[model samples]
Target: MEFKMKTEGFHIELPYGRLDISGNEENGFRPYQLLISSLAVCSGGILRTILTKMRLKVDDIRIIADAERNPKIANRIEKVSLHFKIKGSHLSDEKIAKALELTTKNCAMVQSMIDSIEVCKTYEIIDS
Candidate 1:
């Protein structure tokens, strides 16, 4: 991926569209927002696949992610908390927990930042 410099930051042309990234929030997407989004989406997608393979009918999956950043050290991300609200049928707590475990294990983004960032995952199964 090649990024071209813009007035505010940089823009990358992806197959889907163009993504603008900048330190200022008003200009475009922030770097840290993208980082957290990548991790959250990756885990959510993997969990959805795992639940499907387990034969659970999933109606919808929503993820809420919170991150802790330390300003003293270049404002680096210290920890990330992911809460998943899954709307489905015949979902058991045990199976859902196992699926979450598998998701964390399989998600490449989570694994990539394993050493540097602390990631916590929790879930709620909602009957639909």
Candidate 2:
């Protein structure tokens, strides 16, 4: 996990590959997107594990994040709304609610951003 940095135009040269980053949809992932992804996957993975422990059949887990950024102050993300779509069979609403609650309580990435960004979550359970 060590490499020389390419300082020309917000680029990084890693051993695996080179990353070209910017706010626009140009080449690589924007730094803010990475932050959002960390939170998304963190909750998704933990939720999956919890569902498995509860013996629920989970066909798929899709997580999407809607983030709002301020144009005035450094374009920092003011809020991140996470939407969770769980496709499964025989899933109960009570279990789903509890699972989401556990995800909200356990995700480290989301906790880390609590002081800076407002994190909101929602979920839906679908039959497989």
Candidate 3:
């Protein structure tokens, strides 16, 4: 599968799938938001799967993503922080820590930006 993006004499092909997503710098989801979105989705997906695989009951999972964007330079994100609120019964801190570690290690989007990005996580246990 191949996806293509072409605009104003620039073109790039993505080989992941035919699923193509294209937007300009002015769109609702700016280029920086897209990057953050990718990271959030990757981590969230992995976390959900890992929790389920570990037989942990999840009542609800919410991930709040925040980033510090440098408005001076094309609105680029300098640092990212993710607050994960997992609501369930009898959840263990050890398990949550392991899940966070696993998600950080396995998330492709986060790993890709490891060189130029700072990812922080805060876990919270909420009552359902």
Candidate 4:
């Protein structure tokens, strides 16, 4: 990861694209927003891998993520809840529960912060 300081804030060059982060709320991505999005997508990818290995076909996976932050004590992220919507066929709540259990255990980002942050997961399986 390479970061260059710009007049407005900073430009971080990543594999996907250049991430412009600034204090200006309307101008660029906030640092905390990046962490929240990364956590969601990282978990999403991990879940997809697990499902494929289990021979389950899925049409789409939507990860809706939100976080609670405390600014009084160093602006820490207290908790993150991820609501997963999996669109597929013949999917059962039992299967998803197992998959999510593994996802929480295996996702690198989740594992990194599991001790510090409350990572809660819920799911809905939509038959397609």
Q: Identify the leading candidate in terms of lDDT.
A: 1
Pairs of residues at least 3 apart in sequence or in different chains that clash in candidate 2: none
Give one digit per residue, the lDDT tens place, for model 3 in 1-80: 44344552223345652332445553233456668888888998999999999998889888899999889987778899
Q: Candidate 3, residue 111: CA error in Å?
A: 0.6
CA deviation > 4 Å runs, candidate 3: 1-28
Please give the range of 10 consecutive residues that has the lowest summed lDDT in model 2.
1-10
Q: List residue ranges in candidate 4 displaced over 4 A.
A: none
Question: How much lDDT does each candidate structure score?
Answer: 0.96, 0.84, 0.81, 0.89
| Every candidate's CA RMSD | 0.5, 2.5, 3.7, 1.4
Give each model a TM-score: 0.98, 0.84, 0.76, 0.92
| TM-score (C-alpha) between model 3 and the true structure | 0.76
Instruction: Give the local distance difference test score of model 2.
Output: 0.84
Q: Mind sharing the TM-score for model 2?
A: 0.84
* lDDT, candidate 2, 63-102, per-residue tens: 8889999999999899989898999999998999999898
Residue 31 lDDT, candidate 2, scale 0-100: 83
**By descending TM-score, how would the candidates be arranged?**
1, 4, 2, 3
Evaluated against the true structure, the overall lDDT of model 1 is 0.96
lDDT: the better of candidates 1 and 2: 1
**Clashes (N, CA, C under 3 Å) per candidate:** 0, 0, 0, 0
lDDT for residue 108 in candidate 2, whole number 0-100: 92
Query: Model 1 over residues 77-112: C-alpha lDDT tens digits?
Result: 999999999998899999999999999899999999
